[model samples]
Target: MTGLLRAEWTKFRTVRGWVLGMVLAALIIVLLGVFTAANNYSSCEGPDGDDCPAVPLGPDGSAVNDRFSFAHQVLDGDGEVTVRVASLTGTITYPPPDHDKIVPGVVPWAKAGIMIKESVRQGSAYAAMMVTGGHGTRLQHNFDGDAAGSPGASWLRLTRAGDTITGAESADGVRWTTVGTVRLAGLPPIVRVGLFAASPCDLTVTQGDLGGTIGKCRLARAVAAFDHVSLAGNPWTHDDVGAMRGAPALSQGAFRESGDTFTVSGSGDIGPYGLEGGQPVERTLSGAYTGLIVVIVVAVMFITAEYRRGMIRTTLLASPRRGRVLVAKALVLGAVTFVTALIAALVAVPLCRRILRGNGNYLLPVSTATELRVVLGTAALLAVAAVLALAVGALFRRSAAAVITAITVIVLPHVLATASVLPVELSQWLLRLTPAAGFAIQQSVPEYPQVTGHYVPQMGYYPLPPWGGFGVLCGYAALALGLAVVQLRRRDA
Candidate 1:
């Protein structure tokens, strides 16, 4: 096996064209990545023509929206905050056919009720038991965790003991059921417990005349009236966490108090940042798609060229075992592709990200671990794709036919799915079943069912989870390799 591998590696390296082709693939990845980043720009000017503030980062280091209205009082230690949500109402701007008026309505996921937070700062640790406009009662914590309770429960409570917080909800305030319990690690001794309300922007997606999706987001706000506010402390203080500067007076966050009733009005969301107003880290790696094509061509030719020149007979005689010869070639091709692509990806990601930030674009923040996954995953994707192409080349023994077959299964599906030419459902299915599923490994932004947005392939959402999709592609490659092995063994050299 060692001798066979050495022979295959020697053959690949001695061929100047093959070595140059690998170099060209790496160059394409890095050059196109830098070009894409340099060309992309974003303008988020405030009402006064100044640059907008940076997006907030959650505790987990992902971009998050934490704007809301809070009517809170400081709690010294273990305590409980409870309130009855009387009603939830909101106004939508330019909804649908009439794009000229502000109408009274609540978008699904508008939230209001009681919360126990470490502080009033945006993206702070906290747990909230709230009633949403359409999702009913939910216990949400730290920008990502959510637990559903009884539907349409009007009363909510959050009790904090040490670092653990328990959320319970009730319909009449007499019969209560525990919604959820979460531990807010490192919560300070003094915390803010209060009544809060928030709503995300209203999203409208329509079909374009040319078989594409058109999406628009309009500003929206939610108002919730809470009665029987139960908390013991100083006079209630109101703050709009992460408030937008110079926003319209009607959309600004504020709270009104009358006796024991507190009415809070707020805008923005409290969850994962969806597909809007930011560029993901993977955006810088857009060149991977183009580089994969080059890799496919090179890998197919590596094997098919041997067949065309009638070198396979001599190669099989030298090895005596055809399967081992195929494996040796695949190993050499896969290793060279992986190493070249890895070097290109490592240079492209950070360099392009800096360029993106320099161009005034709000690059979505991701953790170091996630960024590493994206980079390594991209290299793996190219390597596996090359292996698949080699297997197809061995199966067909024709470079053009093999290259076409590999690209159609691996690249075309991704293009059609992400280009918005097909319906979202069909696009998702294509990503799921085809070798293009491997592209899911590059998705940095995740789909949160709690956040209301178009989770479509066109918007960078994949149907399968990252590793799951990669496994599908690997399965196809393995099957192809097995069939190629059988054909090589059965046919005369």
Candidate 2:
């Protein structure tokens, strides 16, 4: 083990470029931290009538109705922007007494989108859904960014099949991901959705000119394109309620009512929903996961680069033992990932907490376990990548091709699993087993009902549970190491 470590150390130290690579990675991580801090601090709002517009976001900016309360304002073209919603103090009544009998109640939904065309100018928009008195719930979809084709490309969809409400997203007008789901309260008597928008600040403008700026944004002009806008599920009416009332008990279970509570129940429960009810910072933490992903990629490339140079043979010849070499490579790779992940989380956590604090109810200080999982799990992910790359590099002894193939095999499975929307049984199996699917741990929310996707032995079917998924990744590493060992013993240096 000592010889193996020393040899691995010698190989890493002998390469000036590799030493510099670690430094460069650290520098990039520090730059990101600086950027996060600068962005958050400059966008801070004051106690009274701050420059930042405060409004709750919906799918798009929709007008509020009797059952819901909403307000919105556009900031400058670009800056830190946020919107929020709070249940207002009134209850609206619907005419249909048995609206519960129809599809139960109205499913209120909302959308928010912003437009950033030119460098200096930008605008924010929102939309909401409100139903006359009937038992229904809100299916709020957040489309806050200015990306996508906008008007059409960036919108939310809420559809109901039987008693289930499915929320989906569309990049173009075609494909979609079932982003989320919710069950409405028992035959809701009424439902309402809210809309909001916070435009970005004009970074080019002087501070003195900021207070005088106000823009006339028309909803009608922006809303005209919504002709294609439609709602699925049961759009119950007053007449249909009589037939639905006192109907046979719901096949799933009874809906419990409370004062605007968010709970998961029924057979269709998809584990837990990640509520965006916190301050701006928490949302930022959730979104910046892409950064961690980038670091993982870099780590993989670092180890694989050696194989391209045919330096790995020298590495193996010095160490002789494959397992120890793999372990040392993993330790270095994990160190790189762990440091990057910690820095990202540390900077993101505080900034996110500050933005989300007080204004919109957000989970602040972040959970210790969650933070540990993010940073340590990220290290583990990179470690696995390093193992796979080392194994591949050892076997192929060619860096570039091995790295490319490793990425294709490891990352492609997740994309395919996500895109496959049919063969419910097959999809379930793929979701748990796919390499990318394992990364879904970052989501912290299960995609479907726990029971719906569970493994079935009789039908010759199996799916990885969360921990089991980790095992699969380990198994891959083990198999690669095993093969590398065989190759090491068989091949001549």
Candidate 3:
């Protein structure tokens, strides 16, 4: 078995064309990655013209939107704030009929309720019991946490006991139902308890004439009127967390108090930042598609060349065992492809990231573990794709037909799903059923059910989780190899 593996490796390296093909594959990946990053430049005209404000990072180190209106006062220790939400409404800028007129409406995720926070800082830890525009009532905490509460409730309350915060909702402000409880580690003795309101931009997606998706985000704001506010604290101080200075007057956040009634209005969101206004690290690997083509052509020719030259009979006569010979060839090819791809990915990711930063583009932060998975997964993807191509070549014994079949199954599905105008559901189905499911390994951002955004292939969201989709591709490779083994045993070498 070891001798067979060594012989196969010798054959691969002894061929100058094959060795140069692998080198060209790696070079394509690196060059295209750098080119993609160099072309991505972003600029925002702020006080320091062409200077963009830094995005806020949440506790988990991911970029987040933390702009909202708050009417808060200091709380000494364990305390509670209760407020009755009289109404929740908002205006959407430039909806359908007249592209220039602002219409009155609230997006589904617009929220207004009572909140308890460690500080007035944008990414500070906090818990809230809120009423959403369409999702009824919810208990949300620490940015990413959410629990659904009684729907259609107008009353909200938040109580703090030590570091534990409990949220409850009521219909009549009398009988309260505890919605959820969460603990904020390292909560200071003094904190901010307040009433708040926030709304995200209204996103509208339409199909383009050319079979692509067109998404437009319009400005939206939510206003909430809070009456019968019950809390013991000093005078209320207004704050707009993460607000940009010198913004439009209408877009600015504000609050008003008339006796016991407080009305707060604000724009922006308090959740995970989507793909807008930023780039994901995987965006730099856009060249993987082209590089895979080079790999496929080389892998197909690797096996077919032996058959075309009538050398398979001599090689098999030495090995005698056909199955072991095929296995040895697969192992040699898979290992070579994996090492080549790993080196390319290791060079492309960081080099492209620096280019992206230099061009004033904000990168959505990812954890170290997730970043490692993306890099390793990319190498594994190319390696397994090579194995699949080799198996297909063994089955067909023709270079052109085998290469075209492998790419049609693997790469074409991805392009159609992501770049074409197919319906989102149909595109998702293609990813699930085809070998292109392996591309899910490159997705860095996850879909948050709590946040409303376009979760489509074009937005880098996949139907399956990372490893699960990779497993689907592996299954195809294994099945193809099995068929090739059976064919090799029955056919004349």
Residue-level lDDT of model 2, residues 1-493, one tens digit each, is 7666665566666767655655554455445544544454334444354543333322232211111112222222212211111221111122235324322221111222211111110111121221111112222322221122222234445444333345444545467545455443231222222122211111121212322122221110001112122212222111110112232232111222233321111111111112322232224444333343444445555556666666667777767765667667766655555565556556655654555453343342234565566445544654565566557666776556666666665665544443433344555555565554444334332232211122221111225544466667767767876887776677764
lDDT by residue for model 3 over 1-493, one digit each (tens)? Answer: 9999999999999999998999999999999999989998886568546575778887777887788889899898998888999999998887556656888999989999998888988788888889999999999988888999977789888989999999998999889999989998888999998889999888898987877578888889999999989974479899988888776565667899888899999987788777764899788788888999999999999899999999999889998889888888889999999899889999999999999999988888999988888988998999899989999999999999999999999999999999857878889998999999999998888888888788899778899999989999999988998899999999998
- Per-candidate Cα lDDT values, in order, are 0.89, 0.38, 0.88
lDDT of 3 at 151: 76
* Winner of 1 and 3 under TM-score: 1
Instruction: Please give each candidate's TM-score.
Output: 0.96, 0.44, 0.95
Question: Which candidate achieves the best TM-score against the true structure?
Answer: 1
lDDT of 2 at 260: 35
| Candidate 1 worst ten-residue window by lDDT | 92-101
**What TM-score should be assigned to candidate 3?**
0.95
Candidate 3's C-alpha runs over 4 A off are: 47-50, 95-100
Stretch of 10 with least lDDT, candidate 2: 217-226
Q: Model 3's lDDT to the true fold?
A: 0.88
